[model samples]
Target chain A: MPTTPAPGTVAPAVHLLAGALRRALLEEGGGFRLARVLPGREDSCAGLAAVRVLGADALAPFVVKGLALPAQDAALIRAAVRAHPAPQEPERQVLLWGIRDAALVRGLAVSGVDATGWEGLAPAGSTAHLLRLPWVAMAAELVRVAGAAPPFAEEAVHAQLARSHLDISRGLVRALLRRDLPSAACLTRWLAPAGEQLTTPALDYLEIAGADDPRVSLDTAIARRLTTGTSP
Target chain B: MTRANTPISPQGDHDDAADRSRNVETETDAAAARLAHQVGERALAWLECMRGSFALTAETPDDHVEGQALKSLAELALAAGMVRREAIAGPQCADTAGRLLDFGWRQVGRGDLLYRLQARTPAATYPMEIYAPFAAAGYRHERMDRLAAHLLGLRASRVIEHVPNRRLAVVAAAATIGVTVPDDVAAMIGQTWLGGTPEPWMLDAGNAYGVTHTVFHLTDWGGRPEGLPQRLQDYLHQWLPVWAEVFCETRLWDLLLEMLIVGTCLQRPLFFPAVWERVAAAQRADGMMPNGLTTPPADPHAAWRNHHHPTIVAVVAGTLTLSRAISHATTAGGEA
Candidate 1:
């Protein structure tokens, strides 16, 4: 016959403990659980232990599983989980909502939604840091969707290339879409005459410019052109 | 007829003297014009050659990368010749000299061309003939000389201080060329020699020597007086030996060309004997010198040896012939 802790105190404490553990598990490098519980009444200890165990293993697999969920529902859970850590703060919740809206407009599944949202949530001046995200897949997906849609044009491609750290020129973007080598080589050659213009910002972008197949000679030629300048 | 029979009067003698003076002045003016014309022609030719080489290098693909090397060597030779000719003949042809001077000054001011020349030629191989024109044009040769010395001295000091192991070859070469090391350069070298602590990279003797040799040639050639036989003598006696050792060890074709330039510029007694020995040792059965030194084997396959060997041998032979002529002239009562 174990004495139960007062219902109000026990419920609030358990909720608060659960909340903290959830935040730690979600935010810390891929969630871990507390192995042992602190000494307490059997019921309270059992609740704490259960929450810790469930929170650690449950959160990761649940989020990973949610990746295949319908885009709308997945977005809702991602927003809920992100906002869960600090529900009292309306601004953070609003920020997470804005990112969810952007992801929805782009038609991307917000699988790593919290990480993605957190990346964009820094204050206005921290945009540079936000831009460092490995958004290649998202950008590629966006480009594909944009191609199918009539509104996406060369202007959109140019803007993306300009803003993104992806090493791609306007011509390279077109080449990527077309999967043509001669056109890519023509652009590369035009940019880097005898490898002189290889290091130009346009060319540097072309070097790490992700494509299904990266042209080594063209990239090298571009790099060389940039370094030495009009190689003669 | 009766007046001439009385022996030309004092007025007639005065007229003749006046006519002679006018003729002399006209000849001088014509000579000046001719010299100027010659300078302009040569300068243009050199510029054209440089442009051609640059174009040739640019057109070459990766597999033909060796074309660039040949172009580089040609450009260096052209630049050296242009500078030397302009400096020597510039005063005699002020207009042409002025143009050439402006060009050289501009190039030197940019710093890149000077660095490139230094990279190619040994420090002691600068053409003394160039300084003569500036001196003739009423420019202060000593001040220019001192400025060059200071610039080279500072560069040497930096290399010695920041990079110590390379100091030996550089310092030894500088000493050989009789390059007056400022107090700072000397101190830095001395400190390094006396077991002063060096950076991690400075511990490798080969790298140190190689880097120092580069700096030495650069500062040395870039630092010499425009025109002075004693300076040339210093280069031949002091600098050439260390370079020879480096040359023998490395057998870099460029180094051989540098040796040739030094031989042509100095024509010192000490140089020809050593150079001839190097030449004799370098000559292959097919009359080709190995493109680069083979000992110490930087690569196992002797991959570095290539077409440049024949070119270097030809350059050395030409330089030797030039040196012989200079030696004869100097010995035949021309200023040593």
Candidate 2:
């Protein structure tokens, strides 16, 4: 079953599979069962896209459900890696390498993954990357699989977050008002590591800024869980 | 005073836009102070040119202060008094401010209309709010102050209902006229939205107005930053930039300047180039900043109706920024 209710009316394959993964994550004590897709080349492509969109987060729900990876779901990670190549840009490579690293770092029951893949993607801890998108998703996956908080501990990252707190907060508010619900939710999740209560009031705005999309719930759920130290 | 033949288009993504934004972000204290003074003066000049258009109509039975032109002139009185009180921006502003103050006082028959209005509704604070600026400038009327003193003592006056920020405005006006009863001020400040120090990012347009007015009242038309407590001061220091960005991007020129005024209300003010550059770019060669992204009307009356408040906001905001910038520089220089 989809974790956060169906998006309804022929949702895209990436979202459908992502929603299933997110649902499995929030289960807390439930078993992991990968959602079944139609048998076609398109289905295989969609699965890899979902795996990329989630990066490490694609496998996080299985870990949360406390299930050892079946070879079939493990094959999804292997296929995603084979399908996607590392990029030259530091941020893009960090994002690309994150999928393989998550599977390895969490020591999932996946096979044929390169142990040295993370070394090829150097500067994996860029400060600017920590401020942008996909970082939050990757971060949420890390938190779920490894019981780690966001790694905003470096001094440069700390200073950057402090200096740009207003900018980040402004982005979230603008997204909420613009009704770009997914971006707003991602920003909400991204701001979870702030020492002060950066968005206690803004959390309510997310409820009112509701979207029909399940990714909104997934991002918001991760944010609330991170901040409150509770299950979604 | 060379006005462009056509309006300077608002900045686009050209290299100059980046340069201008960077210039504002990196200016020295002397540079920032000069810009603030110039911005304030151009806005006041625009207001002075439109002075004749603030025509009053006879009071209708409903007699809402906001529904009458009297409110506009009264607001002009506050802006003029601020320019004169700060008294350091420039002589041109000072001269224009003196003339404008005389014009506003004359428009109200030199406090006679104010006295009559207060007499009719002893509990109505509007006339007294108008009268306070005149009194503060040594233009006090014996009869008006006596009536205001009586009004200030009344239980009805103390209990006159207003939204919390409006209540703070009334209290501020009473302080200017030297007639506020003490506890009313405390209770009023406690009830204001800003006083609560709630999450400022959630502020929409309405709540923003409430917060801006609360700052205007607390700082006493930008005359006294000391009036704002340290807690509220901290709240504004952390939050005003986001509000400024929110308004500037949405093209709410009035609220954007209102936030700029709040910027100056902090105990320690700094030049915010990113927000200020957008505002400077938005102003026309004639000094009119449109209230929104909508093209300003060609008709004078329509333009005035649409833009007068943002113009007034520009005046006060620029002046306060100028005044506070000077204060901040002088203080820093002394410390050095």
Candidate 3:
């Protein structure tokens, strides 16, 4: 079992990754600028070096050497870290932080890795969904940025980015990222598409019909779908 | 419409800070109680207002009469201790003011009331006009209308307490239609109703008329279950369908479904299990469900999506309701 950090200690490894990623973006322009400025053009130079040191990958050694977790656990953490590389773009970096933050806070361990050293990352369609996650402080900062910036238009890319971080089945975030609709209506449309493709129908139904909305038809549709497989 | 021109601190008060604290505490308590009472009383008054046979007629009170009548009545009512000034200034009073303003505009447009008393009334006027009879009843019609309008503007600040974005839209639609929702529901709308002309949708004759009818159903007609279920059902069946057809997308459809499930748990318990079963049955192995039965997928995410949060909440709520119902049924069977 992975050793857990004390409450007051540095946030568990996953959080460290998210926090470090966030700090890299807000304070240090993330690794992109450092990569650009570095002489060797090596992946581990400059800002990328700092991320490698402090992010999810760095936690394995600390857990193995400092916390005394098994060597195999550290190896697993190293492997997962290698698989999900640090995000390059500032927006993608923030999104990674949000997903990891949500996962850690929820106590969900990433599979095939040290749960304590987990990094949360998920695909999200818009800055709005990224901000809507439960990480209050980070989400708030992101919200502030979103409010100041122009509305995001690249829904497909954002959706892909969100999926990479979380365990949400495909297309869930994409459905949420579509043009604004009343909350209830949006959920209804997501759960039960009028289209013929039915992959992952249960999850879609769950996603769309779980929240509130002002539009009554959306609710009715969900209720109808839930009760009769027909929109009410 | 009167702005506070003079600042008067209560006399014999302590230092400014102490006085301010005491004033704030007293004002806050008073405001709370006053709002509570105003909301309750105005709701009652609205019921009464709609009870009698209301007909749209072609009579317009003279503008001067309307003005003087309101001023004299305010003074008499205020002086004679018949009505408190705060009664006209309270939150409920503001809600009334808003409704009446909408009502007045509708009446004018319908040619039931003249636009200007001095001008020729519309050529084809409806009979049985409903003018501001309160002016004749010793209340200031114009001032009362003004006070209502002003109060409505002030009360709009409450809208800010609601939730944001889509949630806000839901609460706003409810408020626009004069549906008194619980505080939690109101909080969903998340913005103050700053003083401005009400939205066109809010004031639209059709919506306004619909509100009047809904209010009547809620109050006088004693519509089933206080007309809440019926009102909600009507909104789902009629108003919201149109809105969905017009502006809603697949994601919005998902959000709406969640709201309905939540709403069913909150408002209509009987329908909970049926709704849940239908949803559960429709779920595919990968956990995606269709949006509406017949409509084309509104978006790509309409397929291959799994949202755990809403599912968990719905499952929990549905399980509880089902357990209780089953227990009830078993007990009844034993007794039989």
Per-prediction fnat values? 0.00, 0.11, 0.00
Candidate 2 off by > 4 Å: A1-11, A33-42, A62-71, A88-115, A118-125, A128-171, A193-201, A204-208, A230-232, B1-32, B57-67
lDDT by residue (B1-336, candidate 3, tens digit) is: 111211111123235755665455344433333332332232224222531212233454443234433322222212112112123334554455444434433444432223243133322111111222223223333432333333334444345432233233333333332344344532231222211212211223233323323322222111123434443443333222222222223233233333332222222222222233344444333333344444334342432122322222222223223333333345545765
Q: How close is chain B to the truth by TM-score, in each candidate?
A: 0.33, 0.87, 0.22
Best by TM-score: 2
Model 2 TM: 0.81
Model 2 chain B scores worst on lDDT over the 10 consecutive residues at: B1-10
TM-score of chain A of 2: 0.61
Question: Which prediction has the highest DockQ against the true structure?
Answer: 2
The positional error of residue B225 in candidate 2, measured at the CA in angstroms, is 1.2
Clashing pairs in 2: A3-A23
lDDT of 1 at A19: 41
Better of 1 and 2 by DockQ: 2
How well is each residue in A1-232 modelled by candidate 1, as lDDT tens digits?
2223356344434443334333432342433232222224555444443332222121222232232333443433334334333222455334333332332322222233333453322221111222222232223222222211111112233333345423223333344334344244334432332232222543444344422222222233333333444222
Candidate 2 chain A lDDT trough over 10 residues, lowest sum = A144-153
